[model samples]
Structure formats: C-alpha cells, structure tokens
Target: MGIKEQIYNRSPLFLQHLFTTLYGYQLHRERYGPVYQERFRMLLEREHTTIDVKAEQLDRLNDFLHFCTEHSPYYRQLFASHGIRLPLTDLSELKHIPVLSKEILRTHMENIQTDIAAPIIGKTGGTTGTSLQVRYTIPDMQIRMAHLDYFKATHGVYRGMRRISFTAQDLVPERQQVDVYWRMNRAANQLLFTVKRLSPRTMAAYLEAIERFQPETIDGLPSAMIELARFAKREGIRLTCQPIAIFPTAERIDAEERQVIEEVFHGPVFDQYASSEGAPIVSECRFGQKHLHHEMGIIELDTDGEILVTSFDTHGTPLIRYRVGDRMTLSQRICSCGHPGPIIESIDGRGRAFIQKPDGQKIFEAQLASLVKHLPNSIERIQYVQMTTDSVSIYYVPDAERFSQSDERLLMERLYRLFGRDIHLDVQAVSYIDAEESGKILLVKSSLTG
Candidate 1:
C-alpha cells in the first residue's frame, strides 16, 4: 500500500466525503460551479431518441467547426491551406476534408490542441505498450469522467459506490514489494488492483483484498478480470462476494472470454467502446445491445472500413473526422432494448488474444503476460507475436540501460517452458515498435489460423 492509502484510508466517512467534494469542485469548476453536475443530471434524465441525438450532435458539430478553425493551429492551417471556408453549413460539406490519422496527431500534436488552457498530458497504456500520449484540458477530462459515470449509472453504478479496478498502473513499483499490490482510493471509494504484480504468487493477496473491500462493482480491462478468474480456478478458490456488475473497458472482450467471466463472477458484464483520446464511441445496453452515442460525435465508417470520429465532446483537442483505428461490423436493426441508436455489431479493438497450438493446446495471453511482469521497470513497451505454429517473436523497446541480453534470455527460457523445447523463438530489443498508420497497436499477429 502507498502513502495515500495510509492517509485517506484511515480517514472517517464524512471526512472522506469532504475531501471528495473539495476535489470534485476543483476538478470540475471551469467558468462556473454546478454546471458539470447539472450537465450530468441532464444527460441522465434525457432519453436519447435517435433524431434528437442527431440534431444535438449536428449543433455541437457546427459549433466545433467554427471553434476548431479559430483556435486550433493544425486545423486552422490545414483549412487555410486547402482554401476551405470557415463554419461549414452542412455535414455533407465535411466530406471534402481528409480524415485525421494518428500519424497527423503524433506529428502535429501542439497544432491540434485548442488554445483554451494549460493541457494535461496523459499516456495510453494499450496493448501496443505505452506509446500513445494525448493532451486534454482539465475540464474536458472531468467531462469525460462524468460521461462515463453517467453511463455506468444507467446500469446501477453510482458515485461513492464501492468499486475495484484492475488496470495497468505501476502500483508496486518495486518487484520486491510483495505484500503491497492494491491501494484504496478512499475519496472515490475505489480499490485499485494493479496488473504488474498479478501472477499466481500474488493472486491470494489480491483475492483477500477484493473480499476485504467487498466492492459493489468491478471495473477495468476484461483481460485483468479474466486473469483473476483463471487464478481463482487454478487454485481451487472461488469468489464468494459478487459485485452488482462487471464493467469492462479500454480493451476488447470476445464471446468466449465474456461467457467465462459471466460464469466466474456470476455478474452481468457491461462493455463499452471508448478511447483515451476523448472519444466515447458506443456502449452496451442492459439487454446486451450496443448503441452509438450520437450525442458524442458523428461516427462514420469509411470505404476502407476505418472508424472515423468527430468528437464534439473534445474541447481541449477538437478531433474533427479523426480516423480512430478501429474496425467494426455495424447493425441497422432496431434494438430489442428500445434504445434509439445504431448497434455496433462487433468491434476489433487493440487487444491481444491467446495463441493456440496445432495439437489442441492453447495459451492464454494474460498468462504469458504475467511471465513478462517480472521484466525490468525500465521497459517501456512489450509485444509477443506468433510467426508460425512453431515460431514466436518477442519485440520490445527499453529505456537506455534498463534491459539487457540476460533479460531477453530469461524471457526466452520462460517461453520455452510453456512452448515445447522444439519451439523457435526470436527475441529482439529494438528502439521502437511499428504501429498501424493510424497509431493502433496489434499486440499479437499469427500466421496460422486458430
């Protein structure tokens, strides 16, 4: 546990609420107080009928059009260079503008930022490793959180509710600190279970902490939840305490994984399609129907099948027609859930899957990932790719003086234990790994079909 755990966790309930109120005030207040919460309530009560949602989105889209050209350096120069007029009248007019790729964002980061306030820079710890960084205004960050909170509330989660998150935070920075794996975010009533120290050795402590906290809701990556499930099953342990819901985010969840998760926890898993770059794309309803948040932006599927997003919600960085690198199969049929939005039939998110052997043997990606948990703290990125049925490649980028040949050999030895002795492995320490042009990471690439 950390110092915040010692200080905040020991505080009384009313005192904790006082801290939460103060922090919420500081975080949400921009031009005035109460607008954030008021907006949250408005969003909560309003039933987003498709037509109303579209009209509202278009209004925000129009406002953003004029706002971006005036305030954003990149969009301003791009429009000026192309001789495109300010304040487009119709959505059809936007067709002339090219889609904003991740390459553009990475190259012209400062240019895309709105000159409103000092921005908070955040890094995305995705499957590609911690390569993608984004900037958000403080108000925009608060709004995003509120937006997520409201969505969670739709399915019965609320503020100050007991929740536990299993995410990719460096909680126990030192590997030797075995006793400390989770810390209490007392103000928010959240228990954070870090992913780095989540192997079988630390599984017991994690379960104990989960039981101790007795969370009302479970949130975070599905990969981590599945990790907990696997650990519990292997050790002949079961989670007696059940949460109201399992909220999965920041990663993809397949049918098999989702089914196993539902069985393990005996709770409904509500999945959401979101990004760190201020795009709240789609969400799953209580009836397991996925609906597009039309109020969020104008989401379109291009000819190349890339999901292009124009987020009105992004004030810090107005991403107009940004090519967010996700491919999805969309549905047009009206949902049985009575939600008035188009369904996201499927999403191919940037998540790694398990590799399967020819003779019916399969390896869980999370299990392999736990092996790499012992890697040095200086390691910035890690990726393991399957080239052939018998061949594997490990690609990693390390901070200077952080990784060595000994580390590579050690990882290979660990892989050999899982894979047979005849398995071919190539481990390389590179300066950087390549991503899709739109900056999406493909964690695992296999030549052989599953």
Candidate 2:
C-alpha cells in the first residue's frame, strides 16, 4: 500500500470521511470548473436542436483528424504511409487509415499521445489482466465529465445530490473489523460503499447504511448492485430509499438483473456504455433507448460487430480508428425519445475477453462459445479458467436429460480441434460457476498476466 493509503487506514472513521471529502473537493475543482460548465451547457443546448447531426460530426471528425496529423507522431507516420490527406471531405475516407488495435495501443502508447503539461492519467480495470493507461488533457477531461453530468441531469440526477456508490474501489481497510464498509465524500454528496467481502451475513449493514443515508441516486458496478438487490429480495426486505435512478457502470446489466435492481430500489436503471480509456459514450435515454452521442465521437462497426471509435475528446491521446474490443448492434429504428442521435440495439459487452494460447494466439469468448452452440439445450452456463498458456479448465453447468456423454465427447473433439494438439483441455461439469472477486461473472478468467 502507498503511504497515503496507510495513513487513511490508520486514521479514525471521522478523519477518513474528512479525508475523502477533501480529496473529493480536489476532484470537483478539476472536473467541474468553468470549462465543464460551458461544455455541459453546450451539450444540453445541442440536445434540443434539429441540426444536421452528420454534417456537424464530419466537421468535428475532420478537425480531430487534422489535430492528430499535426500532433501525434504515430498517426502522422501511419497516415503518411497510407497516403491519407487530412481534412477529408467525406467520412468514408476514414477507411484509408488502418485500424488501431489494442496491441498497437499497448506497444506505441507514448507515440500515440501528444506531449501535454501534467495530463490526467486514467487506467483500465484490467479485467483481462492486461490494464491500459490513458492520458487526458484538462479540457478533454472536463468535456467528458460534462457529458456524464449532462446525461445524469436528464434523468433528474445532479451533482451534490445524495448518492450511493458501489464500485471496485477499496475504501475500507482489509484488516479493519468495523461494520462500516463505507466512506463519505461530502463534496459530491456521495456515500461510497466497498464491494469487497459482501455476503448475506454482512448485507444488513449495507442496507442499514443505505436506509440511513437515503440517497437520491445509486451508481456503480452492476454486479455489486445485483448482489445487494438479490440479498434484499431473498430476505423480503424492501428499501425505504427511492432513488431518482440507478446508474450502472463498468459492467453490462442483463434484463433480469436490471429488473431486480429496479424492483428493490424503486427506481429506473439508466445503463451507459463507455470505457476507462475515455472512449466515446453510448448512454441510455430515459425512454430506455441507447443513443450514441454524435458530438463526442464516431463509432464504426466491423462485420463482427466490434466497434472502432474516433473520440473527439481524446486530444491528449487521440484515439483515431481505435478498435475498442467491444461489440454492439446498431438500430435503424428511431427512438421516440426525440434524441437526434443514432440508436444502438444492444451493447454486447467486451469482445476481447480471451484465453491466450501457448504460442501467443488468443481464443476469444465468441469463438469459444461456438464449440457448444450446436448442442440442443444442453449447457446452462460455461466458464473458462486459464492459469497457464498450455492448459485451460472449462467449468460447465449442464442439463441432466440433454447433456449426454456423446455430447461431452463432441465438445472435447471441438475443443481439441480449436486448441490444437499441444493444449490440454480439462472440461468439468459443475452446478454453478463463481463470479470474480469484484462480483462480476466473467466468461473467461485468465491468471496468465498479459
């Protein structure tokens, strides 16, 4: 642990709250300054306009392309090699540029970025055990924050409103035996709850804390919220706190989980799709439709539904044609909510969650699922655990009547064909597959550090 964390752990509960509030104040200043205010107002005003969305987007895209060509050495060299001229008249000209993969970003991050004074650094959650660090300019950060705040404001959630957050952040000390699993951020009026060590035995404390605080909004990881909601439902306890809305981040929420959350909390769930790497946002409207904010970025989908984003806000580390490793299906049906942006049918979580082979190839989640797709109602759920490059353990929940020995043999044959002779596949039938330490259920869990 760092020295500051050690000091925080050693301090009394009251002091911890004070420290959290002080830190929150610093963040508030950084995120909610005059730039943020101006950007937020612009966003709110833009929502009401029937302006030519595509034309404006193309203009912004051209400007951003010009900036990247001027500032970033990687993009300048790459574009020059492709004979791509800047200030393209049409958006279709983007096809001339090469797609920037995650591997490219990992290898050439420094070259991808423009040198800026004291840029804000953010890191990905490293769900695949390969974390990515991204830098943002102050105005970029402010604009991103403005977009988020404006989205929430549309749902009747605002800054300084009483809110409860359950996230992967470790707020409570591991060794501390106190029942308090939360810290206060008075500057943002947020009660931050730790997602660690949550169980039925300790859930009452969380509920009690929520009841006492009576927050207007709830935000954080969907898995954590689902756990709390499931526990409450199982215990036949209804929360007294009626939040304006529940905002889920980091992880995707299925229909069942969303229903449970809304049922327990007595609020609507506004889902958002964005990345820690500062990808452009696709926020759920109050009408339950997901809209891509055209002002923020351009999203293009490959044949496999993988999205390549060119975010205008990523000036510090301009992400032009960045393959973000997530999949989504775009919708042709216009949303009745009257938002003048493209609608997304569904956000199909992360497409890049994969198990690495011994020879450094990867078998992603979609490809792995194809092995059992031919089976008829046999498998309920499946998970792959990779501790080493050469071997993988598959835990599967099977239907008793349908999952025959022949089906297992067929699965084994398919696995061998996909993995080749060098790999060892250990497929086991299990009643249940466990979630990760953060309570999120991952299809692929690899301990082979990237």
Candidate 3:
C-alpha cells in the first residue's frame, strides 16, 4: 500500500476535485444552471401551485410519443402498428401505447436507439443478481440529477455540503489495511466510502474515518447504515459526532432498521424510491409524506401494481410508459408539508422479494420483517434464501456477541408462521450477509423455479 493513502491533505483533496469537476459537471453544474435553477425555484416558491395534472401529463406524454415516432425505429414501428397518433388530449388515451418491458428493450435495443453520438451504456445495480444494460445520452443524465436536486431539497440537502455517502465506488482496495475507509471529493465536499469492506473486523476503521471527517449529512443505503450501527452497538462504541440528516436509497429499509439507524446517529432517515433507469420516482418530507415527482415523470399504477413511468425530460433514453417492475400505492390526502404535489402512500421495494406461502399466497418481504420487529434490536441484517419450494433458509447478522438459542427458536417460529407446515425453515445467525456483485443488498432471493 501507499504511505499517504488515508491522509486527506490539501493536495489530495485538490487532485480529487479535478476529476470530480470534469466528471460531475452534468450532475452538479447542469442541474444547478440558471435555467434549471429558475424552474426548480419556481416550483418551490409557488404558494398556490395548482396546475392541471391530467393536461400536463397528456402534453408531456404526447411530446414523448412524437419524439419516439420520429427518432426511435422500434417505437415508431410499434406506434404505427398500433395506430397511435400524436397530440394526445386525453390522459386515458395513453393506454394505446403498450407498456414497454425490459425484455422488449433488450430484444430491440438497436431499433430503440436515437442515433445520438457515442451514447453511454447505463447498468442497473442488479439487486436480484442480474444486471440490465441500457443506452443513454447526456441529456438523460442531466434530467436525472435535476430531479435528484429537486427532491434532495425537501430533506434540507443542498449542493456543495459535506455529504458522506457509501456507494458502489471502488476507491479503497479490497485488501488494503488503511487508517481511513473514505476518500475526499473536494469539489462537492463528498466523503466517498467503499461499502465493500464493512465487516466486523474493519468496522472500527470506518468509525475512525467518520469521526475524523464529521460529515454534515449521511447518504447511503440502509444496509450499510444498519450494519454500522450493529457493530457500534455491539462494541459499545459511542459516536460523539452525528449528522444533520440521513438519506437512504436503493434498498428496502423496514421501520425497525430505520429506528436503529436514527438512534445510533441521532438523525432522521429520509428514504427515497428510485430506479436504475434514470427515473427519480418518490421522496419523503418532514411530515413523512411520500411525494411523487410529477414534474420528473408521469407515474401510473398497473392493475398488478407495477409502476409505469414516462420521463418527461429525458431525451437521451426516453422511458415512455415503461413498466419499472415496482409497486406503489397512491394517496388521496395532501401533504401537510405544504408541498403541492401528488403523494405516494407506500413504495414496495422490488418485485423479486415476494415470497410465497404454503397456500399459494405471496407475501412481501417487508411483512416478514414485522415478525422480527417485535424482537430485540440486536438483529442488524436479514436475508432469506429460498433453497427449494418446500425448504427455506434465513440468514441474519446480530449486534450482540452471539445469537441466543431462544432468539433462534423465535426466528424459526416466525418463519414457520409465515410459510406454514409445508415448508422447512432453517435460521442461521452469521457475521454478515453478502451484498450482490453490483453492491446492492437483496432482502430475499429464491433459487427454486416455483
């Protein structure tokens, strides 16, 4: 290793900003440009922000249709075959455009190309052990960040703050023994930490880095935060530093996990709902209201509860009426936060976590998390591996020294209560649960083709 690897002196921070300045121009600069800022500021400033939702949706929907018909051969052929006309005046008329699926995109990827110059290929984090590749342009990147900037404001996270985040970056080498686990991004004041090496052994090194940096906000997935809290609590390590707020994304965080993280850091965990397809979907406010970013996309729910999104401003890879494979419930009540927008009642993580019962009934993984919620706060990470149709294994990480036998029995009982007599449940308490290769933590995985 290097001698000055973990040291974040002025020279290192300056060199880091150079890369961040060029690379993050679209994320930081384009999103905060005068034009983008004006529109974003107006959205926040408008007191009586009552606009015709159906009309705006129809207009944006038609605009997307017209663009697709002109540039994308796949969309053009589909629209022509289905007799879809431009200038849609009614929102219900969007039904004519068939829902675009990921399989269809893969099959006709070239046909969907808009002839943009040297487009970038975007990959989904593949939380379910499978990765998806999609083509995007510069404009698509801008719209994604603009949407992020809009919602981040709701949680009091402005640009250029000292935001410490744990993402899929490979800043730290896997085997290196370093004093710090984080690297400084001087341009944005972001302390980037690698989530690859947060085992029980090196968890103390991570705490040392955080204690030194003293970041303003903590932005990362819930799995990372929960595991950190588990190690701290288990070791009886008291953190004298706390962030202003915590922002979690890209995973399903149950109420219990959020409470533990909040207690450990002494901050509120503001969770967000988004997809890897460059669509910013939902966010929470101070009043715990989940607001749908209507200005970002026109969101709709399928009969099966799949979230269909149309990116109104994404010109690079326009996801018009795209089935994002996630479910959401719409709320009729307005937000008490005084933000005039549509609200989402709830957002179920991904469609992969629906575990089946013995009676052929399916239950969300969040429902199973409730069983352990009544248990002690020692449970940190939870994962279920369905070995077969009649056999299942659950692996969990504990904050205490070890999992007690009674705790194991209670966990088994919960599984039996969930899957019933037809299935065999095996509970194991381990040091840690592995994240996906793409660095996403999946709550459940099924190997059986049932």
Best by TM-score: 2
TM-score of each: 0.76, 0.79, 0.72
**What is the Cα-based TM-score of model 2?**
0.79
Cα lDDT listed for each candidate:
0.68, 0.78, 0.66
Clashes of 3: 0
Model 3 agreement with the true structure over 309-427: per-residue lDDT tens digits: 87765555667778765678887877788666667878865432645555444434434444454343335557778765666787777656434667667667655655667767777
**RMSD of candidates 1 onward, in order:** 7.4, 12.3, 12.8
**Which portions of model 2 miss their true places by more than 4 Å?**
350-450
Point out where model 1 deviates above 4 Å.
Answer: 1-33, 48-51, 125-130, 354-441, 445-450
Q: Any residue pairs clashing in model 3, and if so which? A: none
**lDDT score of residue 127 within candidate 3:** 34
Of the two candidates 2 and 3, the one with more favorable lDDT, higher being better, is 2
Q: Per-residue error at 69 for model 2, in Å?
A: 1.9
Kindly list the per-residue Cα lDDT of model 1 for residues 217-265, writing each as its tens digit. 9988677678677777778777766778888876677888888777777
